[model samples]
Each structure stands twice: as structure tokens, then as C-alpha cells.
Target chain A: MARVYNWQLGREMSYWYPESRPKKQFAAVFDTNKCIACQTCTLACKTTWTSGKGQEYMLFNNVETKPYGSYPLAYDVKLLNMIEAGKWSGKTYEGQTIFESAPAGERVMGWRPEQVDYSYPNTGEDDCSGQVDHGALMQLPHMNWFFYLARICNHCTYPACLASCPRGSIYKRPEDGIVLVDQGRCRGYQECVRGCPYKKVFFNPMTGTSEKCIACFPKIEQGLQPQCFVNCIGKIRMAGFLNTPDKARADNPLDYLVHIKKVALPLFPQYGLEPNVYYIPPVHVPASFNRQLFGPGADAAVETYKSARKDMDLAGLLCLFGCSESLMTRWKRTGDIVVGMDDSGTQLVRVPISEPVHVRTSFDPVQKLVRINCP
Target chain B: MRRRKLIVLPALVVLLFVAGCKKAPVQTTEVIAVAAAQLPSSPTDAAWDNVPEYLAKLIPQDLVEPRLAQASTPEVRVQAITNGTDVAFRLRWLDSEQNDTAKPGSFVDACAVQVPTKLMPNPPAPQMGEAGGGVQIVYWRADWQAWVNGREDNIKSIYPNAEVTHYPFQAQSLEKGSPEQKEMAKRYAPADAVGNRRQSPRQSPVESLLAEGPGTLASNPAVAVKGSGVRTQDGWAVMMVRPLPEGLAPKKRTSVAFAVWQGSNKEGGARKMRSGWAPLAVEEKKP
Candidate 1:
């Protein structure tokens, strides 16, 4: 008979375990199908939180087309290409999420959008007391379809940001799970900036601190939604709790992470950060494309993905989950997202596999939704 | 039976009294560390008194440097310079002659400057020793402009001598990265470790000042000073100032900051002032 260890009831187990961290993990689900790229969410966040000095060029929230779309220039392609070209291998330390191995002075490369070649358009200078030729002629080429993707810090279950911070400046709150950058303690290593796969953590020269989306915990504490979630014009976003692993891994967090798609598919699961944010792949984009982007196990991963994406598609998932809904909608309506969902098909949920959630011998999995089986 | 009943009653009474005493209210301070110290009741005339004296020896007050041309308002002007796919722009004054090379695009764009100024005592003597010198700030407008290249942008403000003396910004504003955008250039910035991109210029000046330490109200009329600098046991800070410069608009409120020195060294203090500069919005009180 399987022993049921009740933590709340204070049942003693044979094994001794340290107290769990106060901060819990969270997940976001996005439905790409309902997305209508208006960029209202983008403006809401930028104007409200990031509209400060150094943030002028930063879109803490941005929408991008798949295939060729990316903010800060071809961010995905650059990273993907490096991995594919064997120039970079996702980091692994004793199979645990240590830090990405350094490539002899090669910091993780980033794309500066300003370096790209494109056209600019004139935004009429109606308010410049006198005529200031303040407009750009740059215009993106129109295409058959596009989808938007909003992005922000994933606040992952096993956040790469937490692992990468050398000074331990970044911490996830035990009470609410919101990741925070302690301004006074941060030495500004910028390692977290490079270590984070999402590239959400940014450096600020003004305060000499690293700043990111706070998930508006101040509001969350009051049972209020985050600024982005509340202001999402499409109403495609939601704030909710995420499930944590009951058992401890001997070596790797990613090992347990990618497999969750059998039940919580992460966006670009192949990248292997074990991100908490999940998405339902868009409709127009072929399932094959998802397989390629997510990996050969994409179908097998659908269950995990579906649990995360019960409501939203990839673009929608990214938008609703983070602080970038406005950009997601904008990119969705525009041809910016090269790898967007196709306009056909109604595949919303992934086929569920009756896999039992595993629990550690010392602890039992508490049910919020999925059934947990403790060993 | 009567004696037994009397014993039980006294025991119950003592027990009840002990329980009541255990339920005492927790003691807590009503005032937060921040609220305890108030802003200076009057303007600081000390910092201002030395401005004229310093400017007199540094450069001719009447010296017509085109770069120092005064704008009617204190607002810093903006302009966009380039427009192609690989967009790049220059920042300069609004009324000043356009730099074929530089232009201000948006009020929300970021910019950098390397000024050699520091916090000074009354008579404006440089105090806090020279730490790393020359800090860069990214400037931006509160309003949104399309993320594009070659967009001419301008913002309005109402402050005195607000025109940018360094017309034609040699470096790109915060919209783009800076040359010293790495950690190795520590001497130029004391706090910058996350590179310059993280600095949000949109933060209100008051919030930024409050993040620093504790200060008391300065009551010296000679300086119209409203606050005194206070050091804490652990060295965190909070400060406030009042009676800002006359002739300044409401937007130009003053926020004071102090840099403490390990020891008082006359020559060291003078050198520190020549090297370091604090982000200031404070104005001098008139004599």
C-alpha cells in the first residue's frame, strides 16, 4: 500500500527534508486564437512601469512574428542558430541548472535591432511647437499572416535568473513567488541578463540596479490583477497559481521540465529553462511547425502543454502570461510574427495522457487539479 | 465541604488573572523611518551662494558660448537625426542651429552626459571625496513615439537656463546603448553594474532621492537651508528639502543629496568636487 504523507496534518516521514521555499511557482496560459494585435497591453505596461529614461528603447513587452520575428533584432534566430550551429549547448551542471558554460569571452550574444536594415515611416510631428522632422520611414513588408507574442519574466519554477545571479541579488518571494531584484544588494553582474533565456532582466544605469516586471505583487497581495493582466485590451490574459514538483531531481531540473509537456508544455520547451509559462500552439501554424520548434516529442508534450494552454495559443499564451499583451496582439494582426498559427483548425486542447503525478516519499502531492500519486 | 469550595474558587480566580495578563498588545512605532524626517522648511541658500562665485572664475558669465544659449523654459530639447533601417539619431537644442550630424528625436529618448560636479557644503566647498567620476543618465519623454529611425521629436518644459549647453549630443540617448555599456568602465560610474539599459529615466526625482538616506530640516537663513544630513547606525538614508530656487517653475522642485566623507581633508574635498557630480534638481536661494 502506498503511504499517504500529509504535510498539513504533520505526519512524520522517515526522510528528513528542509522547509520548502516561501515563494511558490506560477504559470500563465495564453490562447492565440482570440488575439487581435492592438498593442494596448504593450502601451499599458510601458507607460505605466517602464516608460522611464533607459526604457525608451526597451519593450519589456513586445510582440513578434514567428520564423523571422523577434524583438531586439532576431533574438530567437541568433540564439537558436548558435545552438544549432553547435556554437552553444544549453548549460548543464551535474545535470542541474547551473549556468551556461562560457565560450572563452563569448558572452551570450544579443541582437541590437538598430543594426538591422529596414524602412522607416513618417509619424507627423503635430506637437513639436515647430516642425521637427520627427518621423521614420521604416515599414515592415506585408504578408499572408502573422501572430503576436507578448513576453516578460516567466517567474519560472526553476528560474535561470535565480541560478545565474552571482551575487544572489535575485530572489523569489517565498510568500507569493514573485521574483525580485534587491536593489541595495545587487552588484549589477548582468550575468542574470545573459543567463535568462527570455532576456527579461535588464540593466538600469540610473539606479545602478537590474529591473524587471514585478508581477505587481503589491496588487496581487490585495487580490488584484497585475497591471498587464488587468489592462490587457483583448482580455486574453489571466493570473493564477502554478504546480510544483513533489520530488527532488538528482541532477537536472530541465530533465523534469521538458517532460511536463506530457501534461504543461512550456513555450519553446526545447530551450530547456523549465519555464512556468505555458501556451496552446496557434491554429494557423501547423502542428508540424510546433513539433520543430518544441522538438520531436511535441505531440507527446501536448498534454503538459495543454494543461498550461487550456485557454490560449502560443502568441496569446506569451502575451497573457507576461507584460507584453499589447505587442502580442499587434504582432498577431500584423505580419511581424513569421511563425504564427494558421487561420484554420480548431485544435484547442491536447490529448490527455492518464499519467499519475509522482510525489516524493517524504511528501504527498496536494491536488489543485491533476491527481498526484506519492511513492 | 465549605472549606473545599473556597479553595477551588481562589485557584480559578488566579488562573483567570494570569491568562488575562498574557494577552498584552504588541508595541510598534506608528511613524515609518521615512516619515519621521521631514523636508527642509526653507530653501538652501548655501549651495546657491557659491554658484555665482564658482561660475565667475570658471568662465566669463557674459561669454557667448552658443552651446550655453538659454531656453525660455528648463526643458531639455530633443531631435532625431537618422532614418534608415539601421536607425541612429543625434540630440541637441530646439532653437539652436541644427547639427547636420545630430538631432533630438523624442523627449522619451535616452541620452548621456559626463559632467564634473559634486555635492558641496555652504560656500559650495566640495565635500565627499572623489569616488568614481562622471555618471551617465538616459533621458526619455513620458509620451510614446513609434519605434522608428529618423523621427524628429521635441518636448517642452518651463525652467530657467534649461537649454542644453552641450548641443549636438556626441552619444546616442537611452533609446540606444552607450559606448561604455560594460562593467569594466567602473571608474566613470559608481553604481552602474547592470550596464546602462536598466536605468529608468522615467522615475520621479523625489523617489530616487528617497532611496538614498536620512536628513533633517535645514533652518539656516543665510542658506535658506531647510535640512541637515543625518547618518544612521547602518548607513541607509532619507532626505527632503524645501524653499526651492525663485524664478523656477513648479516642475523644478529641489531634492537634496549628501555624500559623506570618511575624514575631512581640505585638498581631497576640493578634488572630489572637481571630479564628481550628483544628479541635481535643486535651485539656490537668492541673497
Candidate 2:
């Protein structure tokens, strides 16, 4: 008799889920509608974590103004433009992802929050107060067309940072799904830096370790919101425990996850990292713009967005997981997918709502975008 | 009258002593010693304390001063080492003031070299080479080299030296041992003087040929005979030594080479060999 060897033996074995996966994750949901572009979050993260000598320009949490906006300097457009202009191609190896390849001698944009330095050198002053040069432009846009997206760590599902770490230093908590990199074990390969689509990971050259948001585990452990969330003047961000399949969560794969009249949406699902951060699609954008940002046939995008929002059905597809072609088709055909209600009952999202809520339509002084609008 | 005065004086003295009676005496405890020998002999003995020196000089300047800590003689400069392994080492530092302090928080804003493990005389280590086997050199060619003619070519950029040539096939045979070896093996009979005559007078053994006996054989020879495929070559024996370094990670597919003791009966088994394994560097294109 031929001996049938079991491939899944030892580490090749069964699923090993740790006990009481500490829901130690610290998460933040920035209500993009409420961001004022005041850069308070950027400053808070800066003064708290990135104030060290090399971190003069480092911003842990930043507010990026999209569609003509950026993080002070707006690296998104520049990077996106490069990527779109066929100047950049993602790294690939033997049909596998090896590392990100940039053109030889291509200049990596440094973190420049402003065009000019604002702080006086060697002053040791906590606040940034400097004499302005007339030649320098301060808030120079003749017309402000960008919307603010105040971002921190998503504490994503299947976090790219955790997966790309070669040293096995990065780990995601089973309970709360909070991903973290162990400072002691990191060899500073910067794989996480290259793999992270959002470019959230920062390399501390001194420690030679990649550092990002810890998700404020202490705050989460105490059952309070994170500092950024609490301090956010717009009050759009929400922190919650994303449920797993074993433990049924408030949202379901089908009903809420699929687009219904009311639902939430995901950002860049094609990145395929399974982000935990869910969004209520910015309403009122043009159909083509929505299709390009979300995907083609977003009437289906609306349906899937609804399934993500609503807590009702799990035809076994959660936004946490990619959906089947059938589900996508159903969503496309019937734009009535219902997403679940948020922590607060104020905003009700659905697939194919009467209309889209465009961020450019109106702006609030405190919250950069208006949350509630008539379709 | 004098006697009466004395008795009164004596009685007065006793009464005064009684009036001055005090409470219990307070005891002072002796100081306990942890051991006088435990103190570091000199300040320089504490060299390993600076953990920050492990980082290279390329570290951005802003991170330097804040993390630099100083200590006394045997001045320890600790730095985080993010090399093949994430281990910290102590080194020297130069401070802005240029004054050397041995206490904690004293250091220079510079980098240091890796400590060589080979220098320590009585350093903590396990036994090298097992009881039966020690250092031995075996020659069976197992190197990939570009051949010129039918002989092993010494390619400068590819190989180490003129003497060090790589054979396309994995193993080779060593001939006429070194002067040191010839002297050590004086007791053994020479190939020509031996009773076993497997070849004619014109044919010489691989050892004799390598020993300047004849230079007619091919440059790269195959050690393995046809039909028998053996991955582990026992002929290329080595004197197994100490265990690998604690920090060295072992890959599943690794190559090992060594020297072994040679014997007449067992033709190819080597003795007293030094075995080592090196990581094969595979080049990859950056993404």
C-alpha cells in the first residue's frame, strides 16, 4: 500500500486560533463628512508620537484633501498621478509579489506638510510659530475644491502590514482584529512599508522598526474611544468591535453588506487586503466618478455596499471577504441593497439611493463635508 | 566628723546615680556586604551598556542625542542592531561636550564595530570537534567553475585564488599531501612501495599525480560513479565540530562541506575535517 502522506501535519495542520483573541484593537472611523481640514488630528498625532528629532516632518495621523487636495503637500495626487500615468507599476516576481519597484533614481517624496518650514530651528518651542515669507504661499488655492479625509490606522482585517512582515514580528489579534508589530522582533525589512497600499507604516530610522497606530489599546481596553475619535470635533468617527463569522456581528454579509437602499461601503476593495474600516459612500459624486473610485457597475457596488451596511443576511459574503460574481450581479441589477445603520441612527445608507451625496456640494466650517443630504 | 562626711558623700553619689537612670540602650546594626568582588574592576569594563551603537552611522541625526545614554569606565554604549538579527551591542560614543562619563546617560553620537567572538580566550563556548574526529582536510572537487581546456580554470572574479579552482562536478581527490602532512604520515607506506599494484608503472594514483607525479589527467573529475545517485557524500568526510551559532537560522535545504580522515581500506573517507555551510545568495529584482 502506498503511504499517503498528509501535507497538513505539524504546522501544516489544523487552524490554530489563540484564546480570547484580545479585542485589543484600537480603531477609528473618520466621518469624512465632518473633517474640517483643521489638521488638529495631524497635530495631535505629531505632538504625541512623532515629535522626536527625525520626526520633525512625520505625521502619524493626517488629513488628506482629496480630488485636488493632499496632506499639506497632498502626496496622494502625486502618487496617484504617477501610478495613473503608467510611470509606476507595482512590483512582481515569478508571478508573485516580491517588492515594490520604482524607477531607478526616482525621488521618493519626503513628508512635507507645508511648502515651507514653519517652526524656528533650535527654539524648543512646542507650538509652530514662525515668521512667514511673502514669497511663500499660505492657503493659496484661489478656489478650494478638495474634501478632507482625516485618517489614522484602520486596524484592518488581513492587514497588509502584518502579512508583509518577513520577520514574523507583526501580528493581528484574533479577538479584536487589531494588527501590531512587535518592536523587539522587527528587523526593519520595510516589507510592511512596501506592501501597505495606504502607506500608513512609518520606519523609525533610530529604532529601525516600523511604527504605526497601536489603535490606542489602552483606551479600547478601558471601553472608551481613542483620543483622535474623542477629540474629533466633527464627531463622524466611530469605534466598534468588528464581529467574526463564529460570533455574529451587527452587520451581515448579504442584507447589510449587499447594497440596499441603506448601507455602508468599502474603499478600494480591489486592493484585496480586507480593510475593517467601512464607509458610507460620499454621496452626490458623478456616476462615472463613483464607478471609477468604487468599481464599474456600482449599481451593483451600491448593492454590495448595502450588504456591508445592513446586519441581516450573510449569503456567506461579508465585505470582510470578497463577494461572488452572482452577488455582485444581483447588486448591479437591483440597486436596492440595504446597508446597516451606524452606531448612531442619524445616517441611513442604502444602495441606489434616490441620489448620490457629493462631498463637493456643500461644506461645513467644522466638519468639512455635510453628512446628511436629500437624494 | 570626717567619717560622717564621707558616708554622706557616698550616699549622695548613689542617690545621684539613681536620679540619672536612663532608658534601654539603642543598638546599631552592622552593614551587610553583597560581595566586594562584584564591583566592576574598571569603568571600561561596562562597554556593552550603550545599546544604541548597533545602529549604523546612517541613522538620521534627530534620533541620536535623545537616545544617547552615558556610563562610567568600561563605558557601555548600547545600540539597537537591526542586521541579519535584531541584537544589541555595546560600543564607544562621542558626546557633544567631548567628556567621557562612565555613568548611565554618557555616550557619543557615533557608531561602533561588531564584537568579534573569536578573540575571547576563555569565552563561554561548547567543545569543538567531537571526541573521535578533529580537523581534517579532504579533497573531492564539488565546485562550479568555468573550464578552460580540460583543466580547472582559476577565474579571478569568480573564484578565490590560482590554487583554489572549482570543479564542475561536486567532488575531487587530493594527491600528495602537504609538506606538513608528508612529514606526519611518514610511517605510512608510499603508493609506489606498496604491495597493492592495481595499475602499471606508467599509471599514478590521484594523490601521486596531484603531488607532482603526473599532470596528464582531466581538470574537473566526477567523484560519483554512474548508476548510484547519492546526495550525501560520505567519502568527503569531515571532523564534525561545535554546534552552530545560537542566532543562526537553519534553512531546510542547506549544503554542507567538510574534510575527513583518509584510510587505505576505505579509499575516500576523510578525517580531521572542518565543515561549514554558507547561505546561498539569490538575487531578486526590487518591486
Candidate 3:
């Protein structure tokens, strides 16, 4: 076994392949609170990449309502149940992850989902717990608590898809840490599909191969953000390169959110894959529930996000979300506004310190007519 | 455990022969390519009766199993004949379960033959070949054969009750003859749409492929090999015929390898039963 540092796990972990450190790792932060389940990101990804014949059932990027919705219908729940059946302590997993717990002669412990499993992509859409009684105006903070979770391939530091492929067809690019399946090499084993805990990898029976998100590498290479990131209507996504935790600088929005302020935490960090995508846990949800999804850092991340407005740097970083077509490499507070800039130092966007107010119109029953007035 | 017995039993037999200080007759099975009086019209023709049979022991591919394990057809009786123009192989394997259909998670029974591009000092790795060493492969699929024979009970036949209310590229669609239909077909089934029209009987179920190591196998695109299979009470008898490549001279000694996949065992890719290299020699007709 080869050992490598997993910043998310805050320790080193073992892997079958030798450690391959990319020049810059692809990273993103999604604020679950701001997502509205519009699925613009999902459509953007589908139209741009996965609109092929065997890809009819695939959604490289999907927006599912959390605690209820799943694409392969409870893919996460099944894996989580398996992990729970094993040993786990606090933030550290004592037993094996899906990759480590593979049976003898197998590369990873995986399950092949039947066709019926994929037949329903959104089996439990918008299902929330603790519903309020009908005809009741009593609004409780805990009632009707569900959020949209926009998911894509994590492009993990230790991708189970890459490790599980017996033919060594799946690989992570050394430049950006984007995991991809080599079409020519893949033999449609579906092992990658089976081994992926997130079920992001898909098998194309037509071509007899497996495929996954390429991270919009073509667009990224042209200095533009991924289609999903740029087209997100909720503006909850921020894509950039993650700096080493120790070397994190305030100028980098990703660094500030993940390393300095520690406001973004990886989803299921206990899986030990050091997944690159981070999430700012929803503040309204219970801490224990958030902890189950984002690990022990949930409470701290929520607190940091709640207090973000008081800190100019944190506030500016928050404003950087979905602000530009290009990947934001740095940001700064200029006067009363925050400006995000790309690697070339070109300003991509500027947001005011406080949102500007607008006038509105209202109608009164006595007048029986529409009225407009400045507030 | 079966693999251990396969290795240990052979070694023990060899040890006993040596310990007895007796001259043991070495039994060798050779596939002699005969210049047929006349080539058999079909694989199941009476001409095949004249050919001698060779027993090949099939071993589990434990190198990549469960992660790669599936039910494997343990042994196959092979017979080969050549008309100096085309070479045909009749492979009979015992598989009580005849699995021919494929579904989302299910597999189809298949078999393949591998021969090196040139005779090597040491045979190419049985698991397709080593880097820089090229191998020619003829792969036969039971599913394709069923389709070629126009057998009902294909995928659509198996799921008889499946109601498809809407399909994007249905024959009735406005884009039926347009490029969009071609694109959709290509995405769904490249083999069907990409100029490779499926022909019954004439178009063999076997595919000709070339490989230069693991993960380097590519379809030859020539459709050079022809094959058919029938399921009997005991198992399947498959016949594959292909003209020997020009590189192999007539009467020259060479070798070929065989691999079998049992769909019932869920065997595919690198998970299947296979044999090491076996001797192959072709004979020229006496004037």
C-alpha cells in the first residue's frame, strides 16, 4: 500500500496506486443553503457532454433534494449503511472504506446496480421531514427542512473508480486531478460503476465501456469555468484550485473558504478519499444531521458561514460564487465592493458591500387600482 | 481451491513419474491443418467427423477474479480442419446452463481464439499478449448468433411485457432518415449504425480483433471471421472459421490459445476460463 496525505481526512491514507500529485487540484465549494433545485446545472452538463445514445439515463451533474432524493435511488444510503455496519469513531473510520473492504481477488467492495435501480433518477424528490399541519400558520425552524444537493463526480484524490478498474483504464490527470476513463482502454467491465460510492461512473452498453465527467477540461483549458459552474442559476458554486492548507492565501477564494475560514467541508470525508468538492452545510438543518453528511466540521462550518458578513475577506469570497466565466484565482476588497479576478489579474466581477435597494409597487383595496411608489 | 488442485495434481503426477525412474511417454495434442478434399459447406457438416479431437483443460482466471469471477466452462473439446483456404475450429464445452441473452446487469456466453502474429521463442502471454507482441483474436458471442439467426427471445423477446411509451428515435419519428437518427443509433449501438450492417448467417457471430497487450484490443473492422453455435442437452458446440493470416506459411508449426466465457457465471472482460498455448501444424496435400 502507498501512503499519501489526505487534507480532508487530516491524515495519510493507503492506496493501491503510487501517489500522483497533480500540479493543481480541481476544487469547488457549494453553499447548500442557496441552492433552489432548479437543475440548471444538471441541464447545462447534460447538453454539453452527456446527451448521447447510451447516456440517456446519465446525469453527470445532478441536483437532488437532500435526505430524500437520489439518482441511482439510495446509492449513498446503501453505502452508508455498509459503512455503518463497519467500525467508525468520531471523524476517523476504523474499518475499511468501500475500496479497502473489497473481498479477496477484487479491487473494491462494490455492488452492481440493476437496471431498475437507475430507472428512477429522482425517486423521492422534495421529500422533507417534520411537515407542518395544514391550515396552520405556526412556522417552526426545524419543520420542512430539505435542501437541494447539486452533485457531480467528486474527482477524488483517491478515486475508487480509478482503483477498481482491473484494466487500468480509469486515470486522474496529473495537471488538474480530474479523473477520467480512457475510452480506448475501457472494456465495459462496469467495475468502476460498481466501486464508485457516489455512482457517478456509468457503463455504456452500446460502446461497451464506462464513462464519467471529464470536469469540462476542454473549457477549463481555455481558462473558462465548467458548464455546470458557469450556468448555475442559484450561483451557489465556486470553482478554483485548492492550495495546500499550510500555504493557503487569503486572495484565493477556495483557499479562504476551505483552509483559512474553514467554512467549507468535504462531503463524507470519513470515506477517506479526500474528495475535492466541499460543502457549506445548511445553517437551518440540525448539527447532528449535517455532521452525518459533512462530518464533524459541520457545526464549525455553519458558524463561520453565519458570521461571514462581519469579515470583509469572507464576505468577498462568498460574493465570488458563480461571478465569472473564468476560474477565479484571487479576490480583493476594493472600497465598498468586492472584486474577483482571474489568474491574469483581470477583474471578472464586482459586487457591492451591501445589496442596493429597489422601489416596488403595491395596490390598495380602497383605490381598486395598481399603484407604484419608492420605498 | 480448485486452482491449487490443478497445479498440485499435475506436479504430483510428474513427481511420481520421476520417482519411479520410468520412461513416461509424453502425450502431446497437435491440431493438424488438413488440406480438405473439399471444404465443408457449414461448420456442422459431416467433413468435421474426420478431424481428431483434442481435450483442453480450462482453468479459472484467478489473477482477476470475484472482482472478476464468474461461472466458467471448465473444459472444451476442440477439433480443427483446413481446406488450405480457410481454417475452421469446432469447440464443444459442457455448460448445462445455456445463457445467451444479455440485460443491464447480466452477461452473455462467449468464446474466443487467440493466435500470435508470428511464432515467438516463448508464446505470448495467454491473457491477450504482452506489449509489443501482437495477437489476432476471433471472438464469438452467443447473443449475436441468436440475433443473426432471427431467434425470438432476444432482449426484446425476454422483456416481452416491457412497454416503451416513447423512444426518441423511433421509426415513426420525423427524424427517421435524418442524420439525427444516425447519431442516435451510433450512440446506442455503434456496430449497427456505423456502416457495419448485420447480416444473418453470412455475417458471422465471431469478431476479428487485434491486440498488442492488455487493454489494447481493437476490432479489426474487416469482419474476417465467421462462426455459429448450437446448444445441445449437455452443452454448446461452437464452430469458428477464418482464413489464416498471410504471415503463417502453410505446413509451418505455430500455436493457438482458447478462452471461454459463461454468461451464467457472469464472466466477461478478463474474467473467464482460458488455456495456455497449444501446438498447431498445417499439412500440405501429397501430390
Query: What is the lDDT of every predicted structure here?
Result: 0.36, 0.33, 0.75
Per-model TM-score, in order, reads 0.39, 0.37, 0.81
Fnat: each model in turn: 0.13, 0.00, 0.28
Ranking by TM-score: 3, 1, 2
In model 2, which runs have C-alpha deviations exceeding 4 angstroms?
A1-28, A71-144, A244-262, A294-375, B1-287
Q: Chain B, candidate 3: TM? A: 0.78
Taking the tens digit of each residue's C-alpha lDDT, what string does model 2 give over A278-354? Answer: 55444444544444333333345445444534532432223212111111211211233433233343223333323
* DockQ, all candidates in order: 0.06, 0.01, 0.20
Q: What are the per-residue Cα lDDT tens digits for candidate 3 across A1-375?
A: 577777665556677677787888898999998999888999898777765545667788988877767888788788787766444465455655665666777766667777788887765465444463664332334346777788999989899888877678888888998898877566666778877888898875444567788889998888788999999998999988987788898888898888888889887776667788999999988787788788778898899889987887778778878878888888888867988888777898888877887655487668788887654
**Model 1 regions more than 4 Å off:** A1-23, A85-101, A104-145, A245-264, A295-297, A300-375, B1-287
Indicate which candidate wins on lDDT.
Answer: 3
Worst 10 residues of 3 chain B by lDDT: B193-202
Error of 1 at A138 (Å): 9.7
- What digit string (tens of lDDT, one per residue) describes model 1 on residues A1-375? 112232211231111112344444444554454556566767676666664433344456655555445555555555556455221122211211112332322222222222121111112211212333455332344334455666667775445566555335677788767788766466343555555667677654334355677776677665455676767766656555544445422121221232233323455544444455554455565566665454444455454445543533332333323332211111121221211121132222222222256545544357435545543
Better of 1 and 3 by TM-score: 3
Candidate 3 docking classification: incorrect
